[model samples]
Target: MRQNNHMLFRINLARRKFLRQGFSLLASAGIIGCGDSATTSATTPVVIPPDTDSNDTPGTLTTTSTPQQVVIIGAGISGLIAGYELQRAGHSVTILEARERVGGRVHTLVSPFTNGQFAEAGASRIPSTHNLTLAYAQHFSLALDPFYPSTNNYFYLQDNSVSLIDAEQHINQPPWPGAVNRSNFYKIRGGMANLPLALSNALAEHINYSSPVELIQQTNDQVTVITGQDQQFIADRVLCTVPLPVLTKISFSPPLSEEKHLASNGGYDYTNSTRLYSQFSQRFWHADNLNGWGDSNWPEEIWQPTWDNGESSGIIQSYLRDVAATELDTMDVEQQIANVHSRWQHVFPELDSYLLTNHIHSWQQEVWTGSAYASPTNLQDSALSAYIGLVEGRIHFAGEHASNFHGWIQGAIASGIRAANEIHNAN
Candidate 1:
């Protein structure tokens, strides 16, 4: 179902300047009322392990106070990285997560698919342009492998007609086509989720599982955070890294300003909506020697192609938009699979026979992360600035949503580090 179903707002700018700058970027500005009219201390809080009652590793050292306490709201990649940076700088940090598991949208469900192999449900691939994540992977001794986009691609049209497609030929063409440098897509050696697991391994002590932040109240002295189970935290600084949709629902001390609300609203619009066109077990088209890329003019459900698993097998993954919208959740799994198959089977008839399993990960169905990354149209500069800006004197924000480079693991890490630095510089 549409996890955390909420409405959002739109940001309007006189012109789209970023696109003119050759980076496909946009910029704008906004203003709103100040909160509580209080001048709070900018010092950061002394952080501790999220759940210390259990035997967890002792977190990193502290620099400022006897224990420089900083409370991070989410335990996803962004939260983890924020803690890591602060700890590395000799500050105490604790991460509180809403879900039972770590890795917000970077979920990887392991199950037998073919000859005892598995596939991914959530965030799968990384691009060469993702420098921050790549650097961290290399630092952690993680192996990387290329995603095979060449082997099996097929195209399906409106009338149920199928055709073999050559992705390389259309690399620099039209209809959202960009240059393919062959090294654009890469995956972790084992699975895409391995990256987050590696990062988590580095910061074991700071994470608190199943602890969702209930309220965030900022005072002149500190920011007080209350958990769902009534656990309270008083820290000098707090990072609000929860997803935009979730953040909008949570209570803030003096209440958020109109611009901040708009930023959060626009952010929710960009982050929560998703589209999953199709999914398949094995590359049936590849067995018949066909590439697996298809094109359709559908509004949300768009393309289909082969997605590889590192262990020498893969499935055909479909791409869509708004799969997490309210209307999509009502459809049964069978109906969803059939809908995908109907769009894909005609392009590669082999899909009709070799289909062993079909699955869909409606990110919007996730309580922690409502959806995948934002679309190009959803990103704007004013929204980005407002979403990323520090609030009051105590409330700071970070996450993939609060990034210039939206929806990538690298962007998430970058935002976390930025938030950490903000805390560090404030103190």
Candidate 2:
């Protein structure tokens, strides 16, 4: 059950560094947005019958045994990759998804906006260091583009004071607040969600959407998965890829390890990451040579999601976590908009004048994904992290929560592959 940043903020009081991180901390610090709107065009999911008659190559592994029947829970990047690779390697894979769409936390949202402009509702940036994510993009032939703005200056609001950080200085700094060297970051050209779509397509007719797993039970030789609707799937191996929060909903027979129970049963701390995206009639800040992105003492990362798009209209997003995010969650949609408008104006004074429409994408709100990425709430959580991804008999686990890269899609991809290999090589 989920949808999903790790950009660190430049917390230094120095003027140039104030917005230097520019919503940097949210993603870098492991805070990320989750639960994209289901209406995104790129995320339209198709349900297909599970693979019954499996495929196989005339290889040693195939000749020795029958193809493994794999049940992969959650069609996120990790789950999809596991399913795709398993099916490709001649295993029968069935992916159970809670939502009608794929790409749990990595989605591209395009709606209620004009002029072919779009915004990222979930994971956006893919750093060069994320070889797995990059390699997949290349595998799918998806184009890449710089994630940061390349024009004018970055904005920051401190003590109700608006200031512009030099664009050159901003770009010269590293990716996060206090990183070693300047690194490059990129996003999929069309949208971030396309990566998952490609994976989903590759596993066509094997993905079951709107089929949430309610229970997972296993015997010595096989595992049985029961969906919320009473549908059942039996597999030689079951890979659970849901976030810790969502994972709590699925009952497990014989119970999971104490560590897994600790991590999923509210023992883990997840960020309440929220993004407020507002579209304007024109690129108003460009007149002042500002990219309409920065940070505020209000403890938020302001981003113009479509800053690079050569469109007449533009959109800006505000990334918030914890206290700031929880505060907005209490209000109605309109109130949330008003609350953001009142505060965001201090950074971009001419905001309300050019505003056309706005929407809030809060990760905690989606039923499938209850919170953002997992971070150790305390020492117990830190200790519990290692056990989160441990394999159970006839069952395995994978997700951003199970990986060191917690908040990024790369984490999910890596963990999925790890679990897939574990099952693939198992006797």
Best by lDDT: 2
Model 1: per-residue Cα lDDT over 157-257, one tens digit each: 76664554565443223334463344355556556677677767767887888888888888788888888889888788888888776676578878877
Q: What is candidate 1's CA lDDT for residue 185?
A: 54
In angstroms, the error of model 1 at 132 is 1.3
The stretch of ten residues in a row with the least summed lDDT in candidate 2 is 3-12
Candidate 2's error at 48, in angstroms? 30
User: Model 2 over residues 91-168: C-alpha lDDT tens digits?
Assistant: 888999999999999878887678777888779887655656755665565655556654477877886788877765
Model 1, residue 74: distance off in Å is 0.9
Worst 10 residues of 1 by lDDT: 1-10
For candidate 2, give the lDDT of residue 298. Answer: 70
